[model samples]
Target: MKQLILAEKPSVAKDLSRVLGANQKHKNYYEGPKVIVTWALGHLLGLKMPEDLNKEWQTWKMETLPMIPKQIGIKPLPKTGHQLKAIKQLAQRKDVSEAVIATDAGREGELVARWILEWVRFDKPAKRLWISSQTDKAIKAGFANLQPAKAYDNLYQSAIARSKADWLVGLNVTRALTVKYQDNLSAGRVQTPTLALVRQQERKIETFRPQTYYVISLEVGEERGKRVQANPYEIKDQQTAQGIVQQLGNGRVDSIVEKAKTESAPLPYDLTEIQREANQRFNFSAKKTLSLVQSLYETHKIVTYPRTDSKYLTQDMKATMRERLQAVADFSPEVKTYIKNGAVVQQKAVFNDAKVSDHHALLPTEQKANYAKLTSDEQRIYNLIVSRFLMLFAAPHKKVQQKVTVKFGKEQFIFTQNKIVEAGWKTSEEQRASTIQWQEGMTVAPNFSIKKELTSPPKPLNEGTLLGKMEKFSLGTPATRAEIIEKLIKSELMERTPAGLQVSPKGKQLLELVNPSLVSPDLTEKWEKQLEAIAKGQFSSKAFLQQIEEDTKQLVKEVKQSEQKYQDFSLTQKKCPECGEFLREKNTRDGKIYVCSSAECSYRRRKDPKLSNHRCPQCHKKMEIIEGKNGAFFRCKFDGITEKLPTKNEKKKKMTKQEERRLMKKYSQEEPQESPLAAALKAAMEKQ
Candidate 1:
């Protein structure tokens, strides 16, 4: 009898199949004598929609909302029905005696596989395969010690509860707001709170008032002729600052004191921390950073799991420290010298069992990296992980921190300097400190000056700062934070600018419309705490879901009762053909479209420029086809050129079948002639 194995995606399935010796490939699975392997394309099934649960919930009416189903059901996604059918058939085959759930080892991964098992009704006993990396050795070891499927029941229950809660709250509140406001608006347990955070930052920027301040500085020299600068105090009044500067014609060094200090290396990257750093250093979006790291984990097999929250390694992984160090040292010769000199030390800061969760911090795996295969962004991220890992084994940076006080006619000024004692783990040139010398009681008269400045407002929220705020408030899980940001952008509530993320007018309006409880991050934090407990088997999923159901009812009622009005900012002058109502301009992923303002009317028209495969003769770029009072024409935005399309009567002179065949044969044999019309037709056919 064969043991069937299921994975979360085709890439992972291929890895498992290679390790399991499943050589024979079927249409949707790989089979060997003893095991058959198949995979899911992420989630093949999702929770049933509200309309699917009850026919009455089909229309967007306020009365139909708060539609909670007693038993939430699941259905296979329409697009992936074929793959689901193959998995179902494979599970029920007479030769298959048992199943192995080899999807990702996280809650979402467990849900992906278990939902399929439920929909397929696979009765056979099942086991779970949990592994952190996609390395062949890890896969082999994982398969050798698979755990009983029942062990992860709590995790699956937690996932189910989270999904159902999101559905109940997200769908109900979204519908209520849309129905009451007569505009397309959405709210969620996590996304709304995140948006509120952005709006909060924007409010600060809007209300901020800048104040002018002044500082008096004195430059004093030591016995060795070395100079030191000091800004002793800040004066809020410009007149006071000028008075002090004038009284102090010059400054003399009064005293010098020195103290030694050491700074430990920063902890390794958690998913959120890495996302923040990537955004700050590379200007990469949170989603882009997540995608790059995920590829490094699953595709390159060079890094450990990417969607982890822990910043330290578990104690058990301590045994592999030397091997991991060696792997990282292979990339840099300086790192190699450090390792060769026995610099790798077992530090508690790097390894602690208590801090680790389902996965450890992001680290370079023991696998040797092939830098050539990685993209530029991947190379940068890999270097960051490896650098952090190397620092864990190196010594702390040491320096001498010095503070000097100088006096100018009763007023005192202070100057601070840092002298590096040792480079230690800080190998970067910027971190290296230069030396400054000073002697106690050595004094010399020096220059004085007054500087004027204004207090600046808090900077706008960028993807990095926004992620930091989310992490601070426990707003969302590391796995879901990037997606929340993307959702806000897609909903047109937030926009990206060089300054940072800015709240649109509609976003401010959303905050005004949403209830305080719904917009507070505390709500999400409390739910996450409960979700964690449920995963640990300390809480009940049923009870948590019941709470969500009650919360949804109250939330919908508050939205319905809101006396606030919504202004249609997107309204256009165009009138709907079906109903005499003003049309509103809406931007979709494909392009912009104008829809009727009347909720009852379904009239909509595309307003974006129509893209055609016609090539422009001047710039060799695609031209846009436009319709005007003069009939059809092609316009090239690149070169500001326009050409009228041939009239139908003028275009009636067509080529014979033999001539067409001859032209096709000539084009196939060589590159097409570079004529305006011919090139356009060639580009169009190539697109087809």
Candidate 2:
């Protein structure tokens, strides 16, 4: 009898088929003598929506809310029903005596396969194929030692509990708020708290008042002409700052102290760390970084799983470090030197089994990466991962910190300097610090000055800082944090600007309307702790879910009873053509739009004016095409130049080849006089 193998994705299934010698491709699966392989497109089943369970739940009403069902049913995703049917048929085949789960090796992966099996009612002996990398060697080894599916029963229970809790809390709270407020606002157990973080920062920024402050500094020198500056003394009052500066005029160095310091290499990249670094260095959003890393893992097969939270490798991975290092060396010449010189050290900081979770830290696989095949963004992410991995095997960075104290009258001023003693693993140009020399107890004349500055407000939260905050708060798992940030942006609750994530007016209002329990990160942290316990078989899913159901009911009750009001700030005078409802102005990352305020209305219109190819005569920038009651016109913001847009039949006449040749020759001979339109056309042709 053949064993049916179910994979998480088609690419993975294809790899399994090749390694298992199941080369016979059927409609939706591969077949061979010993095994047959089929795949799921991520997840083919999800918890049924409230409306799907009963007809009464269709309408948005607070009375029907806290719609907790005794049994949350799972249904095949409508779009992927065909693939589900195919897998079901294969699982129940007469010749198939057993099934194998070959999905991703994590909590979510377990859910993907178990949900499908439950939906299909495929009762058979089942085993699991768990492996980190998709390399053929790993796959073959995994198949040689398959574990019973029962081994991950706790993991599956945890996954199911998470889904059910999200549905109960997210859907119920969202419905309650939408019905009570008469607007479509969303809230989730995890996402709401994440949004509250941004809102919290917004509150801080709005209430902050800048104050002027001053600092007095003294410059002193030691013997051998080595100079060191004293630390600035902060003064809140201008008069005091000026007095201190006057008192410290021409100060002399009284003492010098030096301390040696060593900084170990940074730990390897976990999903969050890499996402944060990518955001900081390339301005790539957290979601974008996750996508690039996932591609490198699944498509290129050069990196390990991307959703891991651990930053340390397993003890077993030490055996393969040399092979992994060789692959990294192929990408970087400096890494090649480290390999050649045998500089790779097995530091305990990077190799600890106890710290690892479902998967070890992200690492370069033994697969040799073809740099040419990677996109520019992928190359950047890959470089970051490889560099961090290589740094694990290098020496610690060493430096000396020197502080000089100067005495003028009764007050003392200090200057600090840091000098690098060894580059170590911090070999990058940006990591090096300048060196300074100074001797102890040497006296020299010093300059003094008062520097005035304004007390700054807290900087806005970028993707990196936001992720860091979420991590600190235990807001969401590394796998789901990026998606949470994206949902807030998509709902128009937050916006990404050059200044960083700014909470929208709607977002602030939503927070005010939400229950304090729902917006606190402490709630998510509590849920996560319980979920971890559930995964380890120490906590009961039933009890955890029961508490969530009670909490969800309480949240709905609070929303229904609150006298607080929410104004639809997005509402506009313009009406939706289809629904006759007042349109609301909404800002999206792409541009602005006017969407109907009514939840039942599915109408939206673009609000941004179209840009024409015509260039401005003054600034050479494209002009905007604005449509008014009178007619369409081209206006240039650069110079406020407005011109009537040409009619469809009044297109510019195409120049003949002879005319073009004459123009090119004329321009080549002398600077040619041309209109902005003519110059734009010429530039476009040259680009071609």
Candidate 3:
């Protein structure tokens, strides 16, 4: 029987088709003598929304919130309904007795395929095609050793449990908070925790106390080179730094302790590691870098998977290394030259079969990349992956150490330097260009030594270093880390200052208003551990989900009981005319708006006035409905008035007949709140 192959994405489908002799391609379909392959557009099926559960839940009502259904339902989105139809049709084909799952070999990938099969009611026995890279050799080898689908039941279970739990907790809690707070606010278990992290950083910076620290440096001479300044770690206290410098008295030699140490070559670049380094060196946000890498992988087809977490390859990948390197080397001439030596560098750090999970670290696909077709950004990202791939097969960089000791006053000081012996495994030209070198067991003589005093505080956390911190805490996976950071900035929980991310006052207020446990990184780490356990079959998904449900309930109860007042950032003095309630103007993803104090009354006015033609006569511009402590009023166009008649701009210049007609036509076609740019600009100019 011909096998029906399901791939997670079009790119994977294309690669698999080429290797399976299924070169006869159709629109969204590929076929061969023995196999018919198709693909998934990420997810063709997803959990039903709150409105899908019941019509009553559509409106935001406090009584209708916390709508946890007995069983979460799944359905295809209307936009992609046909894709689901195609999948089901293929599943029931008479010639297709069994199927192969060639989706991404990860937790989410497992879920993607399983959900489709379940939805289509496919009862046929199934096989799995698990391979990290999409090279012809890897695909052939995977086909040669296909495993029964039953082998990954635990993985599917874990994925399902995660989806169900998210549905139960995220939807229910998000609805509950929106209704209870009488605002359009929403939250999820993962999202809330992520927000809390950003808010915490903001709080730290806002309340930070700057204290001067110290660092000691010296103008030291190399044996054969001129003098240069060396930078070392800072000492926090000025007093302590001064004492150390004074102890040095006149120039004196310091003792150096130098020992030979070999750093194993770094494992191949995983998505997270690459994102971190890119963020550090290029000042690229994690999200931007991921986008760039994704473009190279999908559009240019130069790099391997960009969403992978693994940093090492399985044993089977070794056979295909030469071909993969050849393709990358061809695009980057430097890489091509290194591999021409006919020597492959193999290090445990880069190719530990034991450490590899579903997918390996990102690498170049065996398909040669067409450099001229790539954009400059794509080339930069592609080059990064290419250089990283070439370095894996070069020798480990070796270095020598030198040490010298000198006594200055009661304190005995020491100095050391390192010299590179060889740049192994990373001998490519790019590698050499990026590498930093130092000599070991080396120190300056008395005449060359000088005492310097320094003081500085700890450096603020930047995107690069903060990413490293998040990695250590296992805050989120490589695929999700960038998104978390992006959300924080977009939501205004954290602001990027000159130094680094600073928590905003609004962020601090949110933490105080919500449960502390909801925002803790420990919660995320604990959940990740449990998810991994579920994936491994070591833990039960049911039990894990039960824990999430319990956590959600506790969080809701705490928020309800807490009496702490939220510091409303939109501190306006205007009152609502409808109910004489306090008016609050708030910013949203799109723009800002004014809402009434009563949560039950969904009275909201958009900040944009282009949609509405209403205008303030005083300013002769559209006036947005704003709430403050003052009584309900349409503030003046040029100056705000309390519950009084509208006014116009004092500086309003006389308009020509044509201008007047154009203005009239524009107002007739719009709403007072729909034209934000015009209203805001006119308001500012009129005020001046």
Candidate 4:
């Protein structure tokens, strides 16, 4: 009898099939004499939508909410209906004896496989094939030692509770706010609190007033300098700072305190830390980092799971650290050097069973990577994971930290120095030592100047800083935090600027209209804590869900009764021809656009010029297609050049950008051309 193996994605299924010797490949599954493997496209089914459960709850009406369902169930997702049907057929086949769940080893992955098994009515005994990495060794071992499906029942229960809770709270309150405000205002347990964080920063910046301050600086070296005062002076004390600078003369070191310090290497990456680092270094969005790392985990099969929250390894995993180091030794010279130094895992701080859950820290597989096949971004992400892994075995960074109190006239100035004792794990570049030196009771004269500064406002939340905040407040799980932040951006609640993420005009209004409790992180953090408790089997899923229902009721009621106004700053004078409704103006990356004010109407037009394929005669670049009272015509914005568009009967020459550039360069190089009349006159004058 064949064992049916189900995986989370096609790529993962292929990896499992190779190890299981499933040579026979079909459209949806791979078959061997003993086993058949199939995969789910992420999730084959999700919790049933309200519209699916009842027709009365379909329309967006305030009265229908809080549309709490008496019973929450699952339905096949529309896009993956075919895959779900295939899994059903395979499960029912007489040749198939037992099914093995090989989806991701997380709560969401458990839910993906369980929902399908329940929906398909697979009655055969089932086991779970859980492993962290997609490498061949991991797959082979996982298949050989399968766990009973019943073991993850609590985790599956937690997944259900979390999904249903989000549905109950997110859908009910979102509909209530949208219907009451007559605008597309999205609110949820996680996203609303996240948006509140952004608006909080924006408000802080708006009300903040800059204050002028002064400080005294003493130059010691050609380029090195030290601040003379421990605290900055107020604007009223500017003269006091200047007078102190003028009194600066001979300096005496009153004392010197030195302490030896050892710095251990950083812990392995959890998804949130890596995402934050990627955003800060590469300006990559949180979602972008997740996608890149996911490819490294799944497609390349070089890294362990990328969605883990733990930055530590269990006792069992310590034996494999050396092999993992060997796999990545070729990627960097430092890794080889580490191996040569006996590869001792000095920092025992990284190995703690209590700190690891769902999966151990993100780690490299025991297989070497083929760098040529990886994309540029993939290489970057791989380097980040590998570098962190190698550092775990590196020696502790040692240094001598010294503090010196320098006396300048009657005031005391502080100077500090950190001398590197051992360059372990860190380079001189990262751990720069102060070049300034002074001995006890030594005297030296230095030039001092008053430097003017100002008290700055709070910096805006970039993606990195925002992710850190989300983690601190337990806004969402590491896997879900990036998605929640992305949802805010896509919904037009926040925008990413060069400065950082700023709330849009509509987002500010939505924050004010939503329930105050909904905007605060405490509510979401409490829900997350209870969700974790449910996963640990300490709390009942039913009890947690019931709490969510009552909270939803309160949030919806507050939104319904809110007297706050929502002004459409985007309202336009022009009317939509399709629905006869006034258009609303919005600024997009392309430029300004006018969309129908009514939500039901899907009509929009670009207020700015749209580029056309008709190239300019001189630049050979595409011209803008402008709509006029008479008809449509092409206008070149660069040179203010206009050209008549060809009529229906007239044919215009069309060429690709490459062809246009090639032809323009080839012909335009022949030099200036004379008109026909001028050419004829020149020829006649030559004859005379």
TM-scores of the models, in the order given: 0.88, 0.84, 0.75, 0.88
lDDT of 4 by residue, 430-523 (tens): 5565666668998857667667787889999999999999999999998999999888887889888999999988888888888989899999
Go through the candidates in order and give each one's C-alpha lDDT.
0.85, 0.85, 0.71, 0.87
Task: Report the Cα lDDT for candidate 3.
Answer: 0.71
Worst 10 residues of 4 by lDDT: 222-231
Error of 2 at 423 (Å): 1.5
List ranges where model 3 is wrong by over 4 Å.
10-33, 54-68, 213-258, 330-341, 423-463, 487-506, 570-688
Best by TM-score: 1
| Per-residue lDDT over 266-360 for candidate 2, one digit per residue giving the tens place of the 0 to 100 score | 88889999999999899999999999998998889999989999998887777788788887776666677777766456456787888987888
Name model 4 segments beyond 4 Å from true: 217-236, 243-251, 408-410, 430-439, 443-448, 586-593, 599-620, 623-688
Instruction: Please give the lDDT score at residue 403 for candidate 2.
Output: 71
Question: Please, what are the lDDT tens digits per residue for candidate 3 over residues 581-649?
Answer: 787887676577778877666777765532224466565666545445563345444576423424455
Each prediction's number of clashing residue pairs:
0, 5, 70, 0
Candidate 1, 415: how far from true, in Å?
Answer: 1.9
The collision pairs in model 2 are: 229-415, 230-414, 230-415, 231-414, 231-415
Q: What's the CA error at residue 110 for candidate 3, in Å?
A: 1.8
True lDDT of residue 102, candidate 1: 94
Ranking by TM-score: 1, 4, 2, 3
